[model samples]
Target: MRRIYQLALLIFSIGMLTACGDDDKPTPKPNPPVEEKEPMPDPISEFIWNGLDVYYLWEADVDALQLKSGTEEWKKYLNGYGSEYEELFESLLYIKPDANGSATVDRWSWFIYDWVEQENAFAGISKSFGYEYRLSKYSDSDGVYGYVTYVVPNSPAAEAGVKRGDIFVSVNETDLDVSNYRDLLYGNDSYDLGLADLDVENNIIIPNDNIVTISAIELTENPILLAKTLDINGTKVGYMAYNSFTGTDEFNLALNDSIGRLKNEGATELVLDLRYNGGGSTYTALILASMIDGNHVGEVFNKRKYNDMLQNYYTDKYGESFLEEYFTEKIENWDGEQLASINSLGLSRVFVLTSDWTASASELIINGLRPYMDVVLIGTQTHGKYTFSITVKDFLDNGEVNPKHKYAMQPIVGKSANAEDNTDYGDGFAPDYIREEWDYLGNIKPLGDPEEAFLKAALDVIAGNNPPVEDNMATRSGEQLETIFDSKELKPFGRNMYDDRIDSKFKDLTK
Candidate 1:
């Protein structure tokens, strides 16, 4: 009986072994489906959307973007545009056409694919023909002409002896009419300009025998064109034809040096020629303001107002004092120890020369100084840009700049007002004295010449002509938006409002 039980146990053990062996066989149940990992989300659009939402002055109107900020829906919406970031940015603008069908909103905002290049440009280092000019029609028979304003030192224009008063009768033998002038000058790298001298007596420009061909080249611009002291009615008047307020540490020193020279020369009054200055650094603007009058150091230089949302955000984060910018007397140099005092004129009043080109920081100087002293604007109405912009960029998780792409936006982040909190000159501040570029008969004169219309008008004012007989030129319309458009197309560096001292704060947020 014991032997029989043992045999039964062995048989049971064999059956269990066989069952285990069968489980290890190649007969397969359906393979468990491979688990797929979710794809990583792209952050480009999010970065752009968030940037505009925070810094754009007209952020409230961007309802489409704000609708789905942090959700997958926002990511999906951005991805729908693919990698066309420029298109995505343009769509976010607050735009509406006026009665003239011209889009008027957020015209100053622009995106740059290469931010490094943009930075170098605003610092007054760039490639160009280095000559700026204006296209105008003197008479129907005389035809359109290009008037050279000022040539950059060591530039192609300077090499070709292009002076401030030199005129171009035609480009490449073709008469420069308003219709084709932009195409001729702007769209080409090199062109032949039929040089002409102003026939002052005839009040017309006659073609010179010389035809100079100029090509574009890289140039580091010097903004101070003409700085001299004039003796008018025993009151030493300082005249400076400042092209742009390019605020660099080096540029600030240069500006201080210019003002210092004027001060040293015993200049009681100043005639700031901003006829072709289409705005630049606000830091430089403030420096000029301080140089004009340093007594207002502790007082408010200008008050900056951001969008309602950004304003509240800033006030919450940085206290209420963040909005006000006081006049700074000292400019600390690139080296921490290097410092220089602002060359303050310490005068009661100053005169500013303006044209259709005078805008941004130029207007800031005019508007900012109104409360403290007289800023008698001479020439036509300004370009009417009361808002300023900052350079917005992307970053990596490590706080360094993201190398994935080089994109930046110069969006209108805020509007600035003087100490009085007055910022209502959207149509531009009209000149106290209306002066014309061309005389009644039509002739463009040298910029710093005492006989020039704008400079002469300023000199007349300093000589106690309270209100010189206003010109019918006031009724004549000039290209008000030309400066802004030209900056975008011909010379991109022209449209700048970067403040070295203050703009660093915006950069900190990016980091």
Candidate 2:
């Protein structure tokens, strides 16, 4: 009976324990949990130019874009012209917008492969077959006016029946100021036959209604301009203005011979004015740099980089893909001569005149020369591109040949030590003796202007040597290093492992 009563009491206690907890505190409500969001993909990863694995330039949290379908919003332009564009979509890269709907880019990823040129260069093209023209400063007819006393024979202008006596009148209704004419006609004057009716310049023949203005419309005809060397203050600056770097071998040859002649005739300072040199053949680059750096000829200071992945690329549903077979089939691209030894003109003092149009190899010469010689870089801060690139040749998977390109890129890849050996210029080499920052000095001065200032300043410092603002180099001692001498005498000659074998053998002999 007592056991049964105890069991009943135990059951009551158990029920009380199961039903109750803390009586002092009221029950509190549980807080709701927070949800997490997934991270976005890096746009740079989506961009692969022929498998050129340019990584993420910077980290970013992108904003929403406006698009109808595939989820990408914004515009992309073609990079360069010629084969690379037709095949590799080299013109366009991917991009992500920011918080304010503004498009953003980094070295890793721009909306297109051509972004650097588009944002930086004076002009860019959808197709890049090397051709240049001159905009006439005084154009009355369809021709733009420039000094045409030395047009190359059999050139487009020579074939078109234009001559030295002719002053360019107008080109497609766009009149050129004498200042920017040389590069304008060749660079800024590409016309699409398909877009004839939508002519923005009204320089196209649109049926009969716009006949008067259309009369000035000249198709893609690169004119040959004539020039003769003019003496500049007895220095014989050899003022042959090159409109473009596209090789007219005969023209360049004549120019070179003329320069040599100028040297003989008392042209002490050779001013190779490339302010208008928009760029051309690497073949020509060596010849030109050879003329300038005459002494230490063939010192290969710069080299271009080539990647097979970037050589032949095709776009797929997933993204861009590299062509191994194509790249392997023909590894040899670009002329071999371009990689030859660097040239040291060996000039104690060099004065270079540059402008925005002075680019590519022109910039390369400037940077490499700085480490070895005393140079006074005149003109504006250069185009700031100190690099080189090689042409890429590739084939498709099925052995079909795709369009190719110069595979253009700046590959100086590192800051170069200049000829003078003081410092290295990252983008563009600033002049040792800066006159004034003239991004557009040539525009303000006459045609033969940049050299004028550079020559004046250079002449002042030519026969003299100048010292650096300061010199700082490591001179200390520690476990890694020890002093070689104490007060101009050898200190005890404490031989270590470096000299162990020889030192021990010679110990008895010395003693």
Candidate 3:
């Protein structure tokens, strides 16, 4: 009986083992379906600072060394001085391998300095002077924050201010620790600010520049000047906010037309608001200077880099020539064309409102007009970026296909100046006055020390004129905004009661 029991148990164990084996062979449940891995992004080429892509450049002060490869005589001259950059200059000159001395850029090469400076002492400096500091303004990388960037020309700040690698500390006096400090600076005509208390722990002030506190202070905008006509006493005072000269012919035509209308409307004096104008074209400076100067004035003579200037350049991202095509047939001559043409408006010296943003072109107007008329530059010191530089921005690649590997780099290649001999104001243009004024939050008003001084000075000058005329800006009919709306295109607004009121005031433009 015991043997029978053992045999039965063994048989049962074998049967259980067979059942388990069969279960394991049944399709293995598909292993839960494996997941797929994603592929990585492809590597592309990159650009570097040192490359062969400089299109625009300030006329360089290159020694014969940079010009050695032209001819046997040229090579002899360059070799005499021990040089090696012949290949590149040849490319710019469009010369073949065997070409000699036929470079024609000299005709277009502008005089770097006034008569007093030495010849080619340096490549293009008009004058040589020393300064302790230079006040500068520039937009942040993203262009949101426009810094009142100042640099010491020869002092430690000049030598060791913020290094290229160090980012500037951006702050607002009103909010103290916050960014967008300009909030304390913009205002609506009447502005006032009282000095505020300081904080010990944070080392910040309580009530900062009032203008900065106003919502009007923003650095991200294009910062071009806005126009506003005002009524002063009985005279017609034309208020024009002149910003950058970068605008095309359309903008200039509008500005010139506005000036003409104002003159015809009986405006005795014109107020040009240049608080936000960061200077631009040489042609632009000439046009503006013509209105201010009594005669053809040689304001500044700049040495433009790249004698082969073709109006605007063409690149993948930025294109030129569009401005020329749209606004004008060609660039107007700075010396004769612009000044001669604009002066036809029948006006005298213009009262211009200036600020730190009043730079290169602005300075030219001031200096150039000095030779032609009495130009009262009433403002804080101008932006000292007197040394004009040509910067060429290009994309460099990593010798591959993907565009992501590219980088944009800019190199300063040339310099500029006005008709006057003076060019090297490395620190900045000095304002006739530097008093600080602020709105309620302590944000500076009148656009800083320079602008405030210029405005008051101009008003004073105009006020003291021989005629001693009363302010007549309020009564001007031809140049009035009311008349501007009288145009057929804009007349549609007349359907409303507001248009009727305006038409009554300005309908008779010729009078």
Candidate 4:
């Protein structure tokens, strides 16, 4: 009876423990698996929107754009389009309306699909047939023709025996016109360019059987075209025909070498020929200014003025010292190697040869130096670009460029001024001595030639000769050619400005 009672109690205890265990085991909860949200599409458009909204100089003036502040709404607006962010960007640009309701300009803002390509172009590197040409009529009713002005060394065009004076009457047997020349010569990598020669007797461009087949390839340019110290009049002067301001280590070394040679030659005066300079780097412009006048290292070289918000933001973050750039005698090359100290003429005045095409950093040199010295302009008006830009890419929180798209926006972000804070060159810096070379249709001369129109004018001015009366000296012994194309079509690239924001700590803040 005792054993039976003990076994019964033990079994009861076991049953109670089993029941407790069963009660302690919580009921398995029924839950659905987590779902990962699809990544937001078209991040590049967001980048464009963010970049332009924050950094563009005329951000407040952008009309017709009611941007949403929330991420969902912004993405919704972006998705409303079919990934054509370029058109959206174009639409978002600040356009100035005329009285007639036509938007005359949004000219400065630009977009680049491939930031790599834009970077290469800014560095004075290009992949093409490698020749710079001008489209113009040689004589009245002679029809439009392409004049080969510059052929890069070791380029396909140079290898094909195309010289500077060679003329092209057609491309792939199609007569050259304003409508077709750029498309034919620059549009494609490979094409047959038809040759032409000047018929002095007939005042026409006669076609020839010579066909030059050209294939495009990458070519790095040497921007220093000609640098020499010439003894003209009674003064020793340094003459440099700089084509472009490519701010690369190789370009800087060459520029330093040129300046060193000028110093060694004891050049008391300087005449910088920038007739063909379409401009490139502003830092190089600063270095060149230092090379011309190294005596003022601590003085303000330039003052950058951003849009109101950015100006306040930069001022608060970087202090008042941020807006000003002082001169420096020492500069490092792109390789981080110390470049030789800059040389200077230390003159009270400098002469710059200009044309309508002389722009950007070239103009920056003209404007930035005026507060310190006399800048004598000796050609036609300039292209009148007074803005600076930065390469803004779509970057995520990790500080990496977003892999979703490869679009880059290079919008005009700010206006620059000299120490005197003068930014008024909108109509271009009118020449102290004006010589319009464009009116003289057939008088294209080699750059370094002393007899060249602009150089001669500069020499005549330096010799104390009074400015000559306006006359058609460019008229060759032929009929005046009727120009079918505008002179602006000859420009290969527009003016460019690199970022002037010196404080790297606040660099990403602007973007």
Candidate 5:
């Protein structure tokens, strides 16, 4: 019996071995190794694309910006740009020339190579010589000359004795003209200004022997250039020459103190001089408008209009109140913390001094206050900018700016309108009384001086001395000089109006 069982076991083992060895029997195959994709080479370009796609004011107008995020096509397009991120950015803007070779819109959107420099600029910090000037062409020739408008205290320019009304016809002893003025004045960190005198009678510039050597150094400008109370014919007229709308803590405090002083001095009327203000924080604009007239608290100051996607998203998430900015009774910072109760003037009429450089928040003050008071303008037409932008950067998952690159974008994300829905002032707001400072360069006066051209005009209007039509025109000798450029135009934050609230309100969208 044992021999028979051993024979059966051997036979069964042999059959199993033969079946395992058979070639026709299939063997189990291991799963193929998973493929891995290479990471994106240029994150800066991706950030630019995503940001513009989500926040550009004219997103629908650009075909490339309409691509779905993270799709293969979008990824391909983003990779195609490689290191030419600036070209990609320019290509996506809505200012493309039409068949007639004219740009359609969006002349203010720009890219920042260094966000640190940009943030500093927004806070009124820059590497500057501490002086502002206006460039004008010689009435009789093609040469150009610049006159010092104001000198910042303790700046390099101020240390070098540069003062208001100082004129310069050359930089580093090189004559300035239409072709080389920009390069000569702004191309270097240090330059010697060849002093000159404006001979108004001959409409020519006379070069002087004096030369002022100035260097660019990091400086923070106080936007409150001049604030004083002028008693014009028994009427207390407050004159404030505010240069920019920087909304820093220091700036807010300074503005509060200035207004407090004006209020304490028994000012019944205001003449806001925004001749050199190129625009700044919308929040600052709201605070300033509130300070100008406190009669309407919680009333609509201005309305914001965004692209369709952001509009619908904001509307659905935050309701209508999110789109409108209201006049507040208290001053606050970007975090919504109350800094101080606003020192409001509560006046019903205000006189604004404007120029081609007065724009953005400056214009907002004029337009927003028109419904509540008499906003009489006294200078040239404004710079005609109705849109606002926000700084967009590549942010990591931790809400920190990506340290890999310094690229940032200041894209026009929305348009601003007054409560009456009045916007699109492309030609700018015309002054009720025209007073062109460049036209009277020969007779420029100190900012707060009662005899100054623009301030005098405002005071005259306030004292019921509206000059006749013919008398309002600026008197010039020989050929009339043409204004070529403004010193503020060369600033990195050129004619910018920014909404700082977007950083907190739309944080998720940027992410």
Candidate 6:
């Protein structure tokens, strides 16, 4: 009876322990599966976004650029555009709204598909037929004709016997018109340019049987078109039809040599022809201005204003003096190698021959000299671009170009102000003597001819023979043709005033 009682008590104790353990323990649960997302596939878009965010002139005005990169929202926004990086870039530009509620989009900033081509163009090298022309519409008909403005020496066009002042009415047997001019002439790499002549009395373009077949080949253009001294009514006038401000070592030396030659010939005054000069390097512009007048070597030529971010950074780092570009007495190549002392004319007055095509660095010459001398303009209004751009490439941590893509950007990074703090020439600088080239189209003379309309006007002014600034179209019998386009506008470097110092300025910060 004692053993049975002990066994029952032990069994009851064990059951009590098991029940207590069961009450104390909790049940196990499986963890929810984790989500894995695919990574984004666009580094080009990221590059562009990052480049513009830091360097864009109007970054503050662009809301999309403010989004922190690498975040979910930033990734979403970028991925929404898919592969259309250009659309993404174009959307971020700060375009002001006009009075009519239309957007005055920024026309200066541009995208580059092939940075190699862009760099080549900066050096004044490109695949071209070696001739620039102006397309004009007949006053009475839809027919269009192109007049050769200038031809590159030893180029395909020059080899084919094309000359300045030659007219073309058709391309590849197709008559050029408003709708098909671009497609006909520019569409093909090679085409037969049908020659034409103007009938001033009938106000028509008569096609001729002569045909000049030309092809576009890679060519390097010498920007110094003509540099000569002219004897104008006992006044020794220097005339230079400078077409571009290519800041190459060769170009800089050539320019210095030209100016030295002019000075050697006893040039008392200067008549600078920039009718077709769209623009180029700011450094080259400074060099040219210094050569024109050496008195203000240390004076401020222009001041640059960047976006808020860059403005603050640069100001704090380099001070106000860093933003100012002064008149330099010495010439240097793009690589910062000292070339030579500037050959200054030391003239108190200068006459600039301008047109609607004269812009950027070309315009800079006018504004920079106005503070120091009398700048007399004798053509149509200037192109009116006070802004400048810098080439922004996708650079790796090693300071080399990003190897995955050839894309780049030429963004308007800053606005330039003269010593007077003036940047208000958006409507362009009006000519003191307005002489439209189209008005005397059929009667056009060679560029340096003393009888040429623009050069003659400058000469007349220098000779104290200030001819009346009247429209010559009334004197001519033909109806004044409307200029549809200028071939310079199609160039890769369109009125660009690029600063080569940008890379050096931002190098340390980027690294």
Lowest-sum lDDT 10-residue window in model 5? 467-476
Residue 93 CA displacement from its true place in model 4, Å: 1.2
Residues 275-335, candidate 3, lDDT per residue (tens digit)? 5455555455545555444244332323232223322222221343221111122224323
Q: What is the Å distance of residue 478 in model 3 from its true position? A: 49
Model 5 per-residue lDDT tens digits across residues 36-59: 643564767778888898899999
Compare candidates 4 and 5 on TM-score and give the better one.
5
* Model 5 stretches with alpha carbons more than 4 Å out: 1-41, 98-100, 469-478, 504-507
Q: Candidate 3 — worst ten consecutive residues by lDDT sum?
A: 494-503
TM-score of every candidate relative to the true structure: 0.83, 0.42, 0.41, 0.82, 0.89, 0.89
Question: Which regions of candidate 6 fall more than 4 Å away from where they truly are?
Answer: 1-41, 96-105, 474-479, 504-511
Local lDDT at 127 for model 5: 85
Cα lDDT of model 6 by residue, 1-511, tens digit: 9999999999999988887796777677888888655356398888888888888888888888888877777888888888898888887788755578885546688888999999899889988999999998766678888898888879999999998888899998999999999998788999999998878786666788999999999889999988999998788899998999887878988999999999999999999999999999888888899999988889999899998878888888889898999988788765677879899999899999998899999998898888899999998889889988899998887889889889998888998888898888887899888788777766778888999888888888888886878546735643555579899987998887887677722434431
Model 1 lDDT-worst window of ten: 479-488
Q: Please give me the total number of clashing residue pairs in predicted model 3.
A: 55
Q: If the candidates were sorted by their TM-score against the true structure, best first, what order would they fall in?
A: 6, 5, 1, 4, 2, 3
Whole-model lDDT, model 5: 0.86
Model 1, 322-421: lDDT tens digits are 8887788888654544568888989778888887778889889988989999888888888788889888778665667779889877778888899999
When 4 and 5 are scored with lDDT, the better candidate is 5
Error (Å) of candidate 3 at residue 291 is 4.2
Q: Against the hidden true structure, what lDDT does model 6 obtain?
A: 0.86
How accurate locally, in lDDT, is each candidate? 0.76, 0.34, 0.35, 0.73, 0.86, 0.86
After superposing candidate 3 on the true structure, give the runs of residues whose Cα lies further than 4 Å from its correct spot: 1-175, 178-236, 297-348, 389-410, 438-454, 465-511
Q: What is the lDDT of candidate 3?
A: 0.35
